[model samples]
Target: MTISIAHLGPPGTYAEQAAVFYANWLVKKTGIEGILCPYPSIAQSLQAVASGQTQLAVVPVENSIEGSVTMTMDTLWQLDSLRIQLALVMPIAHTLISCATSLDKIKTVYSHPQALAQCQQWLEMFLPTVQLIPTNSTTEPLQHLENDITVGAIASSRAAQLYNLPILANGINDYPENCTRFWVVSEGEVEANYRMSSISPSHTSLAFSTPANVPGALLKPLQVFAQLGINLSRIESRPTKRSLGEYLFFVDLETDRSSVQMKSALADLSIHTEILKIFGAYNVLPISKDLI
Candidate 1:
């Protein structure tokens, strides 16, 4: 059977590149040929998996320069059937694409909010007077060029090649260490080859909310991990959308979820938390320099 994989795209998106990279890895690891299905948005790509339109979906979770991608995080928390299968890191190199060849000819710049934020310094230093507009996806702006030389898009280099647009600037991201962490989620559990060893230490992602709006409500859950010596790699708080002052905490711990210390800590944490959802436990793959 062919595995249908979904990703955000129009073609030549960073998400599409990630999907392709993971597809190759998946085939090498399992001998299964994977087909890539591109969707309009990250949420829709993930929804395709939950709705059984596809077997797997790859979505961005966080960026090294821009913190977390809020939509990916919030949607993952809301979707119950989807679980992370593996984590892949991709080096991000934002480029300035337009019909014109010179940077000064560009009057307006467009890109996804996250991409704009990552290239904030470079834009400010060079195109200080240019109008910065946010689009839904990074490459979505490419379709709006309308033969206008003043319109520019901050997108992937591959996007420039695909759209036949000239890359006015390269490596435009302010930080040289720009990278994004992507999560591969699916409706069914992954096979043994994809599963990280429970015996070895691994990364675990979970979301939880406090029982009440009282003082120290958040501190108690964190204390459980601290007391257990469980190292938290990342923690983010998102508005729960239920009420004012209510929020959900998403945490990534360094130990395997099946470990004794993690289980005990989670059990103790349950007493203090109103709801807890363990998303998944998986291994992380670093993006190679050649892949960038």
Candidate 2:
């Protein structure tokens, strides 16, 4: 059966690129083809999975430079039984592109709203508070412009080249450590990382909240990992529907809990926390540098 996977945009959106990246990787590994479904928003992508219309969906959970995506966090909170079965990171390389003559004459900068926000520091430093226009996605910043030499768009190098836009500069994002981590949500076993199956099963992500909603309740479980030398890849706080001040913590522990240390920590944490759910344990493959 062909796996139906969801992402963002029609094509050339970062989420779509990520979905294609892993889908192509899967094709290379297992010779299994996938159907790529591009949704208009992350919430739509989540709904596709929730309704069982797709086998999996790739959602950006966090960006190395920009921090967690708050919308994705809110969606996860709304999804009760949804699980993140696997995760992978992709390097984000932004470029200043134009269809016109020179960067010196350009008067405007256009890009996906999030992309523009992420590059605020660099823009202020270089563009000198120039007019910035936000497009729906990075891939179409050029399409929104008036197609003149006085305006330029900041987008991926792939985006520039694909649309015949000349790249004025490469590696333009403010942070060099720019990588977006994406979650592959699914109910079936992942056939993508069978080569590293043994090592992959040791990493797990869990979401929980404190019963008392008291101070230090959330940090309590983290201390257990510190004492046991369990590495936490990422931690994010989301609003819990229980109350206005209440929150839920989503944490990723480096080591899978088959070990005595992990099992003990889970048992203790469960006793103190209100809701605890293991998202999944899967091997995350190393990401490659952006080819642009």
Candidate 3:
């Protein structure tokens, strides 16, 4: 079946590139293709999947350095319309892409804010005194720099190639290693290459918030995880919306939802917080690089 996988943008961005990676994996493993769709934002993409406009959608959940994306985290809590079919971890590698043929011609740098943060150190090394411009998306700045030799944009090399821009330098992230984990979500049944049974299958994501005034409310769950030997892969807290004094916590742990341990943890978490919700766990295909 053609599974609509919503990514970000028309052709090239980290999300679109990652979608290609996912498509290759799914086709090779499950024989599904021609359904990879790209959207502008997670909300738009996730909405499509939730509305049945698309069969599936890919939403960025976390960056290795940047933690969780607040909107995505919020959706995990508020949007109970869809279930997460897979968790994909794609390593992000930022490049110093430019429209100019030579680095000497680049006087101003343009990129999305997140890309700038990711490559802050590397950009500082070469363009410390240069002007930094923030645009809606990395690809947008690249598109805007079409004929301006004095302006360059940092984006994916795939984007650079698609736009016929040049990559002046690559591996420009401040950290040598940078990656983002995304969720592949869908409304109903979908085909995949792997099953939970292959990798201890049962899993889910929990996003919650508590009264900031309460003491030790946050500590309660961590204490439970420690006591339970639950290996937490990630935890990020974001300030609550429309409330200045509250905070929301997004946590990812590996546990088979069918197991007693998961049930106990969920039950305990429900009692420990003001609110808690689960985004269901489904099968996730292994990222390609993991094979090598």
Candidate 4:
């Protein structure tokens, strides 16, 4: 059967690249034919899977430079049916795609906020006076490049190639080791058919809200993991939106959800949390720079 994978696009966004890698992996591992469905935004791409419009969605969860992707985190918490099936870490190299003859000719720059922020230092040094506009996706501004010499967009090298746009500058991001972590998410339980023997599940992600805002309320659930010797790889908090100080905590454990320690920790954690969601345990695959 064919699987429909959704991603943020006008075609050449990083999310699409990650989805393409995952789709190719699916073909080689399970012989499943995968078709990509591009959405205008990350939230819509994820919503497509939650609404059953697509079988899976590939959305970015974190970036080495910018930290957590708040939109993805907030949407995942709000959507009850979606769960992460796998994670892909891909190296990012932002290129300046434009029709301008040189950097001095560009007046306005456009790209997704993350891309813009990733290259913030570079932009400040080079195009200090340029008007920076945020678009829904990196490739959203590509179409305007050919018609306007003064317009430039920050995007992937693959994007420049795909759109046949000229690269005014390469490696424009602030850092050399820039990368993004993308989640291959799907509705309901993660199918065993998609799991590969070569890949080992290593991380478990979950989110929760405390029963009360009282002192030590959030500390209770954390102590459970600490007592079990569970190492938290990452922890982030987002506004619960219900009240001023109320917040939701998202954590990534180094152990799988089915592990004995994790099971014990969860049992103890339930007592301290008002809501707990297991976003699922999944293996992480790193996409080599050459692959991109």
Which candidate should be chosen as best, given lDDT against the real structure? 4
Q: What is the Cα-based lDDT of residue 28 in candidate 4?
A: 85
Question: Which scores better on lDDT, 3 or 4?
Answer: 4
Best of the candidates, TM-score: 4
lDDT of 3 by residue, 241-260 (tens): 76776787877777766567
lDDT on C-alpha atoms for all candidate structures:
0.87, 0.76, 0.73, 0.92
Candidate numbers, best lDDT first, in rank order? 4, 1, 2, 3
The residue pairs that clash in candidate 4, if any, are none
lDDT of 4 by residue, 1-292 (tens): 8999999998899999999998888998899988999998889998999999999999999999999999999999989778888889999999999999999999999999999999999999999999999999999989878999999999999999999999999999999999999999999896766554465579999999999889899889989999999999999999999888899999999988899999999999999999999998898889998888
Model 1 residue 205 CA deviation (Å) reads 0.6
Distance from true position, residue 58, model 2, in Å? 1.2
Q: Model 1, which residues run further than 4 Å from truth?
A: 144-146, 193-201
Evaluate residue 27 in candidate 1 and report its C-alpha lDDT on the 0 to 100 scale. 79
TM-score of each: 0.94, 0.87, 0.89, 0.97
Q: What is the Å distance of residue 230 in model 3 from its true position? A: 1.2
* Candidates 1 and 3, the one with greater lDDT: 1
lDDT of 2 by residue, 1-292 (tens): 4678988765677787778777877777777677899887888888788888887888888888778877777776677567766678888988888765666687888887778877888788878757998876676556755458778888777776667668887888888878888888864445544224445355778888888856778778888788888899888888787679888888878886567778888888877788887776665654687522
Off by over 4 Å in 4: 197-200
lDDT value, residue 291 of candidate 1:
67
Candidate 2 Cα lDDT to native: 0.76
lDDT of 1 by residue, 1-292 (tens): 4688899988788988888888777677777778999899998998999999998998999999889989888888889767887889999999999887788899999999999999999999999999999988888889877589988999999888888878889999999999999998987566655434344537889999888988899999889999999999999999999887789999999988789999998889889999898888888877685764
lDDT of 4 at 76: 96
TM-score of 4: 0.97
